[model samples]
Target: MNKFLEQALLFDFYGELLTDHQKEIYEQFALEDLSLSEIAEMKGISRQGVHDLVKRCQKTLEGYEMKLHLVEKFLSVKEKVSKIDDTLAEWECEKNDPEEMVKRIRKIADAIIEEL
Candidate 1:
């Protein structure tokens, strides 16, 4: 996964655990695409302070992921759904037996739901 996307996912999964101040700074840096200097200026802190806070936020979010694995599970489910979609598309192209295809799709869907 892309680094930014990975960070975004981590944040999405665990951002609420952060303090409001931490969340605001992280959102500015990660989501709003602000430079460290820009965030420092906006937050009335030194650039290094903003950098340290952002790093701490990243570590905290990653720690949550390591313990909870919510993001990992979410990504796994997403991949499985994509596979189900691809299987259906293949069935459509092949024009195979409808009943058998339905059974296969149902099995895949069931597995996905079970994982959830």
Candidate 2:
């Protein structure tokens, strides 16, 4: 994934684990795209303080992602589903071997169940 999307996903997944104040500031600045000065003015903090808080929150979110690998697991499941879809499409085009297609479908179902 691209850097921005990766960061966004990590922020979304790990953000709830943050402190309430951290969540508020992070949501406003990171997700809402507020400028530091604007956030500082809203929160009654210095711009430098807001900047530092955002940095700390970012580091904390990254730490969770690195340690837990929740995002990695989710991405792996998504890739498997995509591969299954491609295989089904190929089977449909080739119009050959219902047995193999059934087996593939079964495997996909099993994999999705395991993911769930």
Candidate 3:
């Protein structure tokens, strides 16, 4: 994964655990694509302070992912769904019995739902 995409996924999974100030700064830096100096100027803090806060937020989000594994599980499920879609596409081209494909897809979908 790209570094920024990984950070965005981590934030999406665990952002609610952050303080509002942390969330705002992180969103500005990560989602809004603000430079550290830009965020510092907007937030009325020194550039180093903004940098430190962003680093802290990344560490906190990574710690939560390490403990909870929600991001890992989500990626796994996403991969499985992609596989299911690929299977369906293959089945369409091969003109195979749809029953088996449907059953396999359902099983994968059910497992994903269970993980959630």
lDDT of 2 by residue, 5-112 (tens): 776788888888999999999888877889999999999999999999999998999899889999898888888889888888999899999899889878987987
Clashes of 3: 0
**Runs of candidate 2 exceeding 4 Å displacement:** 105-116
Candidate 2 lDDT at 113 equals: 79
TM-score of 2: 0.78
Ranking by TM-score: 1, 3, 2
Q: Tell me the whole-model lDDT of each prediction, alpha carbons only.
A: 0.91, 0.88, 0.93
**TM-scores of all candidate predictions against the true structure:** 0.91, 0.78, 0.88
lDDT of 1: 0.91
Residue 90 error, candidate 3, Å = 1.4
Note the clash tally of each candidate: 0, 0, 0
Where's the lowest-lDDT run of ten residues in candidate 3? 107-116
Q: Write the per-residue lDDT of candidate 3 for residues 42-115, one digit (tens) a residue.
A: 88999999999999999999999989998999899899889899988999899888898899899988988898
Task: Name the better of 2 and 3 by lDDT.
Answer: 3
Error of 3 at 27 (Å): 0.6
**Model 2 residue 46 CA deviation in Å:** 1.7
RMSD of 3: 1.8
